[model samples]
Target: MKLALGPLLYYWEKQTVETFYQQALTSEADIIYLGETVCSKRRELKTRDWINLAKQLADAKKEVVLSSMALLEAPSEIKILRQICENGLFKVEANDLGAVQILAENKVPFVCGPAINCYNASVIKLLINKGMQRWVMPVELSRDWLIKILAECTQLGIREQFEVELFAHGHIPLAYSARCFTARSENKAKDDCKLCCIKYPVGRPATTQEDQQVFVLNGIQTQSGYCYNLLNDVPSMQGLVDIIRVSPSGTESFTSLQDYRAAVNGTGSPIQLASKECNGFWHKIAGFQTQQ
Candidate 1:
């Protein structure tokens, strides 16, 4: 299966984003997704900047896809989405239904990001008709759920029309809200907040009353506290998945990519890092629990 670098979910400086992609050019990842998929307020890299970076990565022979924000709160955000769709270079990863509608209207082939609600074959078939070239399985679905969806697709004779990508690694993105959890954590209102998300590169962590890590707060996006690792499950994906996505977290993400590549190639065992790992969602268990 091909390895893809999922879009950067955390906010980073322009220099940091540039350096990460530069390193990604030499990494084993075959596909690279660029653009901000979270809050629009995190504009470290604007639309033009993202397009320029996409051009650079495309020039280097890396398959690039521009990702859209998961939550679009205003018309300005829709304008930004239009600009990304009209770029005419790399593919676009539609994170929400509005993006899917815009892409459908433009007749642009796009990748359906995991955040998009594609739960059934009817939705899959509809998206395939609307120029969906690939679809990332929703993070909450299990392997059996995917099998059932694919089975329905097979019955409909549309299984091969699009590629299947799994959110193989990284902290699971659970939800998005109108309120910025990060800003709230800093005792600031979402509107008047001074872009506090940039301060925490990966995101601010939220723990339970027992001091047990439970969630990560990044702007309005809520992610799982534990890092979702699927290195051991690579073999299980074999022919069912076309690509495995590894979401970029921080400076350590590059090494994680290398390790994932090794695991895919059977050259190395799964790296057991210091972070808590979970694959329960993939195994049809509780999202935060480990079933392996």
Candidate 2:
């Protein structure tokens, strides 16, 4: 199975973002996705910068893909999405229906990102017909659900038409909203608010009254409280998944990528699940619960 580095979901300093991808040049990841997928206001890096970075990674013999924003709330966002689709040098991961439409209209083969509401084989078939070269299964879906969907695709003889990717690691992106939760948390309005999300490199953790961690607030994106890990489940993903995506959180992400690589190669010791890690979604259980 191939390892892919998913796009950065949280905002960070411009240098930090550049440094992360520079280190990724030698990481175990086979494919690297670059972009600002959450809020367009996070201008630490612009569209030109992302395309330039993608070019650098492609020159290093790594498969590079430009990711589109999950939510486009303005015409300017659509303009940026069009630029991403027209990047011609690398594949684009369509995160929303508008991106999908743009890519399809341009006759560009793209990867359907997990953010897209594609739950069944019918949608996969439709996307495949529209030049979708790969499909990243939505994070909320379970292994059983994926098996059923792939079976249906196989029955339709379109299973081999595209590759299947799984969001195997990192915090699960739960949802995206028009409101900026991070800005609101500081009693600031969405428009006049500064880029406060950059202050929290990973994301601000949200807890319940009982101090139980529930979710993470990253600008407009809400993520799972605990990291979603599947290092121990790599054996089961061998034949089913073509790419295993690990969302970059920080410097330690490269280490996690190494561990995942070792696990995939059958050269590592048994991995210990951290206290704040969960993999229940893959086992068809509560999302925040760890099966082991």
Q: Which prediction has the highest TM-score against the true structure?
A: 2
lDDT of 1 by residue, 142-253 (tens): 9999999999999999999999999988999999999999999989999988999989988898998998889999889999999898888888888789999999987577
Per-model C-alpha lDDT, please?
0.90, 0.93
* Prediction-by-prediction clash tally: 0, 0
How much does candidate 2 score in TM-score?
0.99
lDDT of 2 by residue, 1-292 (tens): 8999999999988899999999999999999999989999999899999988988999999999999999999999999999999988889999999999999999999999999999999999999999999999999998899899999999999999999999999999999999999999999999977888888898999999999889999999999999999999988887789999999999899998999899889997776788899999999999999976
Clash pairs detected, candidate 2: none
Q: Which residue window of length 10 is worst by lDDT in model 1?
A: 268-277
Model 1 has an lDDT value of 0.90
Q: Give the Å shift of residue 182 in candidate 1.
A: 0.5
Q: Look at candidate 2 and tell me the lDDT of residue 127.
A: 98
- In candidate 2, which residue ranges exceed 4 Å CA deviation? none
